[model samples]
Structures are given as structure tokens and as C-alpha cells.
Target: MPEPQQLEAYFALTEAVSLLQHQVEQQLRAEGGISTVQFQILMALNGAGQLTMTQLADGVVYSRSGLTYQAGLLEKAGLVTRGPSPEDERATLVAITPKGRDTVAKVLPGHIEVTRRLLYEAVPAADLRRLRDIMSRVRDHIREEPPRSAAPRRRRTS
Candidate 1:
């Protein structure tokens, strides 16, 4: 078990993340008609141009089925497209559409604003850098394990 102070910090971090994610999701829905998960997919594709389904699942830290469902919604909205990967027949590729880019562009300003207003505004200027550094380190440490995509699927029971 973690020490008392460590547990306290963990709870505080998770609660803060939950609160922040809730507000971010609301903003994304209101401003872009997109869910937070959809936004994450778009943001990743916007930055990378395209990614394999497994890659996206790992990057977004979402389950494969969940990512597929969200991708389908994005495709229906003309925001993204899914195609079989040229490099790997077994893999599917996802790419952001022009509309997706536009949606991201539309929502980015508000995203930044909300992040600044709700998070940064409450933190001391001096602690901002420290907080970022600490979080980065923690993230790196946690990611030392294999990504979710690398895990084997369990057998289905009838």
C-alpha cells in the first residue's frame, strides 16, 4: 500500500483530473458538438496526420472497441475516415478530415481558455513549472509498462 501522504496526493490528483475533464467535456460538447474522447482522437490525428487503430487506442488510452465506436461517429459526421492500412492488411488507419481540422480549430481557443481559467488561474505562477515537471515525470514513469494495445485479448465465454 502507498504511504498516507502518497495516497492523499493520488486521490487529490484523480479528483482534480475528473473535475477538469468534466468541464472540458462540457465545453467540447457545447462548442464543437464533440465528446472529449472524440476531441482526443481529432487532436491526435491533427498532430500526426494519421495513425493505426492500435496506435490511436494506445495514444488515447482508450479501449479498442470504444475507439472504434467513436471513430464511427466521427466518420458519420464527415469529420474522419477509416481505411485499411496499406502497410498492414490487418491494421486499420484513421485520418482526420478537413471538417475535423476545422472543428478542432473552432474549439481550440475555448479549450485553451478553459484550461487556463480553470486550472492555471488557480495555481501559483511559481508552482506551474514545478507542477508540469512533476506530472511529466509521473507520466513517463507510469508509461514504462507496455501500452494497452500490446495486451492479449481474453477468450469470450458463452
Candidate 2:
């Protein structure tokens, strides 16, 4: 069992993350008509220009089927496009459209403001530095597991 202080720290960290995610989800839905996962996918595509379905699944830490569903929604909304990759026939490439870029640009400022106001405003500069370092280490440790893309898929039921 963890010490009392360690348990408190873990709980606090989890609660903080949940609250932050809620705020971000609300903002994304209101401002961009997109969910947090969709926003993540868009941002990833925007940054990387284009990526395979596997790449997106791995980068977003989302399940392959869920990513496919969200990507379909995005494509329907004219925010992204899905196509076969030239280099690999087996791969499906995803790319953000001009509309997608515009949507991201429109929503990004509010996202930044909300993040800064909610997260940054509460922490001192020195503590923020420590938080960054600690979180980075934690993230690296957690990511030592095999990536989502490498995980096995569930078998279909009859």
C-alpha cells in the first residue's frame, strides 16, 4: 500500500486531470463542435500533415475502431479526409482539410486561454516547472508499455 501522502497525491493528480479534461471537452464541443478525442486527432494531423491510421491510433492512444469512427465523423463534417497511402496499399492515410485547419485555428485560442486560466493560474512558476518535470517523467514511465497500435484486437462474437 502507498503511504497516506502518496495516495493523496495520486488522488489529487487524477481528480485534477479529470476536471481539466471536462473543461477542455466542454470548450471543444462549444467552440468547435468536436469532442476532445476528435480535437486530438485533428491536432495530430495538423501537426504531422498526414499520418497512417496506425500512426493516428498510436499517437492519440485511442483504439483503432474508435479512431475510425471519429475519423469518419470528421470526414463527414468536412474537417478531414481519408485515403489510401501511396507507399503502402495496406495503410489508410488521414489528413486535415482546409476547413479542419480553419476550425483548429478558430478553436485554438480559447483552448489556450482555458488551459492557461485553469492550469497555469493556479500554480506558481517554480511549482509549474517541477510539475512539468514530474509529469514528463511519469508519462515516460507509463509509456514504457507497448503502444496501442501493437495491442491485440478483440475477437468478434458470433
Candidate 3:
């Protein structure tokens, strides 16, 4: 286990991230009928034009099944559609519909405003830059590390 100071720092950072996520999610939910995860998936599709389900799952922090469920719901809502992949018939591709794009356009401005107010307005430009640099480095380091044996695996157990 980490020492007390290390644990405290971890807790504090985790809480901060959670709070930010919650706030953003609440704002998105209030404006759109969709959750932040759904909004993110839409945004990814809008940005990328089209993506495989696996690509969408990687773009967002969603489990494959969870993303599929969300995509199914979105499809039923007329917000997105899945089609056969052009490059690989075996793979499926997901894309945002015009309705989805319009919905995202309607909500994106408010989302950006809230993000700017919560993050940018509160920090000095230099500090924000430094923070971004530090976070990027940390993300790279973690991604480069081998999967830890002790890491929790997502599997059902009887």
C-alpha cells in the first residue's frame, strides 16, 4: 500500500476528477436527454465521421458491451446508425446521423462554456499549460507500462 501522504494525494486527485466529471455530466444531462457518455460518443463520431464499435469504445472510457448498449439506444432514438464497414465486411461501422449532429451542435456550446469556466477561468494560462504537459507525460508513462498482474480484470464470477 502507498504511504499516508501518497494515499492522500491520490484521494484528492481522484475526488477532484470525479467532481469535475459529475458537474460536466449534470450540465450535459440537463441540456440534452443524453448522459455525458452518450454525448462523448456522439462527439467522437461527429469528429471522426465514422468509427468501428471498438474504435468508439477506445475513444471513450466505456466497456465494449456498455458502448454497444448506448449505441443501440442512440440508434433507436434516430441519433446514430450502424452500417457495414467498407474496408471490412466483417466489421461494423457507427456514424452520427444528421439528427445526432444537430443535437450535439445544440449542446456543445454550453458544454464548452462550462468547461472553460470550470477549468480555464480558474487557472492561470501558464499553470494550465504546465498542467496539460504534466498530464500528457503521465498518461504516456502509464500507457507505456506493461499491464500489471494485480490489475483487476472485468469478468463475471459465479
lDDT (Cα, 0-100) at 28 in candidate 1: 96
RMSD of 2: 1.2
> Model 2: per-residue lDDT, tens digit, 80-142?
999999999999999999999999998999899999999999999999999999999998988
TM-score list, all predictions: 0.96, 0.95, 0.86
TM-score of 1: 0.96
Which segments of candidate 2 are over 4 A away from where they belong?
Answer: none
What ranking of all candidate models by TM-score puts the best one first? 1, 2, 3
Alpha carbon deviation, residue 121, candidate 1 (Å): 0.7
Which residue pairs collide, candidate 3?
A: none
Q: Across residues 11-62, which tens digit of lDDT does each residue of candidate 1 receive?
A: 9999999999999999999999999999999999999989999999999999
Worst 10 residues of 1 by lDDT: 142-151
Superposed on all Cα atoms, model 3 deviates from the true structure by an RMSD in Å of 3.3
Whole-model Cα lDDT of every candidate shown, in order:
0.95, 0.95, 0.86
Clashing pairs in 1: none
Tens digits of per-residue lDDT for model 3, 1-158: 88999999889878978988888898888887788889999999999888998788766857777988999999999989998999999778998999999989988988999889888898899999998998899888876754332245578899
